[model samples]
Target: MAASVIELSDVSVVRDGNTILDSLSWQVADDQRWVILGPNGAGKTTLLQVASASIHPSHGSAEVLGSKLGAVDVFELRPRIGFASTAMARRIPRDETVLNSVMTAAYSVTGRWNEEYENLDVRRAQRVLAEWKLSALEDRKFGDLSDGEQKRVQIARAVMTDPELLLLDEPAASLDLGAREELLQLLSGYASAPSAPAIVMVTHHVEEIPAGFTHALLLADGAITAQGPVDEVITAENLGETFGLNLSVTRENGRFAARAA
Candidate 1:
């Protein structure tokens, strides 16, 4: 097995007298792509915050890419971790070109200012756009794109810096069926690439679990219900327990689907 890219031990996060994450322990390794599934308020996003070095645990320790969260300089560590979420996308300038949006990630900034970028940076951004099938939309405005297009562009931006770990929150949450499938296919292809970064995506629907994901983590109310291989951890019973309803999980053509029983 590859080295652990993320390790959390007895981690907990408290805010406003409420425990957002409760003594959670999890590990992610290189070459493994994970899907985090749970109901609302399950601390799924909180887990990603810890993994991305955006927050320190209220208790226990977290080591991401070999650097302890509280002991290391997080600003230095954050650049190596790529995170893309709807909140992050909301910060992007509406009129910014897609190319610049992706390129700005190289500088760890959101909006482009008077900063000068070298030709190499431009070419790399172009390549990332092409890799995400957005070469034709490079000149388009970020706000001009559809929800699905915007999601793809955000992912392209997240990975433009070639991060060691990628964290995505609901990358397929709002898309229609065709758009969702298209993004899923693209994600499946990206996950299969040998050089792609380790990925952890948070999604509510099992149907959103892209192919090539190796592991699953089921969370309910900030505690883990199951954690292991996707097949073994995401059983119907586990899903039912996590969601507070009886569920039937079925797989077809290498994808997962869940329904309330």
Candidate 2:
């Protein structure tokens, strides 16, 4: 319901004298899809944790969907945001049916319980599975699917509730070239849809960024190196600064490619 889907002003996260995020200020409007790009230890995932309300910032303010992080009941706020990550994937039962893996999101629980689910929930899961091309795998155990298929299922499960904001952490990680392209195509199509939820995906590789993502935030050493429209923030100089290397970057047909120059 808020015009600003996510806003972080002077946000900092510290633990045991280590600062994971350093005085970060960022905002995401309702219409934007953002890619988080940074090298390892750049605090990309830390930033997502703050935005998704999994943790409060040590200082400054965070607001998502009109709810301020520290002031709101996170349990109530959690379901309004959809998050998918490797840590979350580990929580799902390996033998869980693909259909129930998604259907369980409606109740905010990890596994299907003895409580009866509504017919509409099942229908919604079916539709989401179809959207991710997981309809055929609905009867299969989650563990039986390949890495790429499991990632798609996770994305589908995250969107099952139609969250106002969707957060994906390395949705394309560890995939073969073909699988990576497949997931990227699906994400690009989802992002291009005007009706899709505002999205933020964290990835270590520039090539993993989907075509329709509109904005980017580049972080390095726990601070922002660049943040703006995708084309501007992804230039060679900016990327070089972000990654501590001399780099050459190119974009064509809404996709990006980069290498050390």
Q: On residues 161-257, what C-alpha lDDT tens digit does candidate 1 reach at each position? A: 9999999999999999999999999999999999998999999999999988999999999999999999998889999999999889899988998
lDDT of the candidates, in the order given: 0.94, 0.93
Candidate 1: worst 10 consecutive residues by lDDT?
A: 252-261
Q: For model 2, what is the error of residue 7's alpha carbon versus the real structure, in angstroms, after optimal superposition?
A: 0.9
How accurate locally is residue 157 in candidate 2, as Cα lDDT from 0 to 100? Answer: 90
Native-vs-model 2 lDDT? 0.93
* Reference-based TM-score of each model: 0.99, 0.98
Judge candidate 2 at residue 180 and give its lDDT. Answer: 98
For residue 107, model 2's alpha carbon misses the true position, in angstroms, by 0.6
**Residue pairs in candidate 2 whose N, alpha carbon or C atoms collide under 3 angstroms:** none
Candidate 2 stretches with Cα past 4 Å from truth are: none
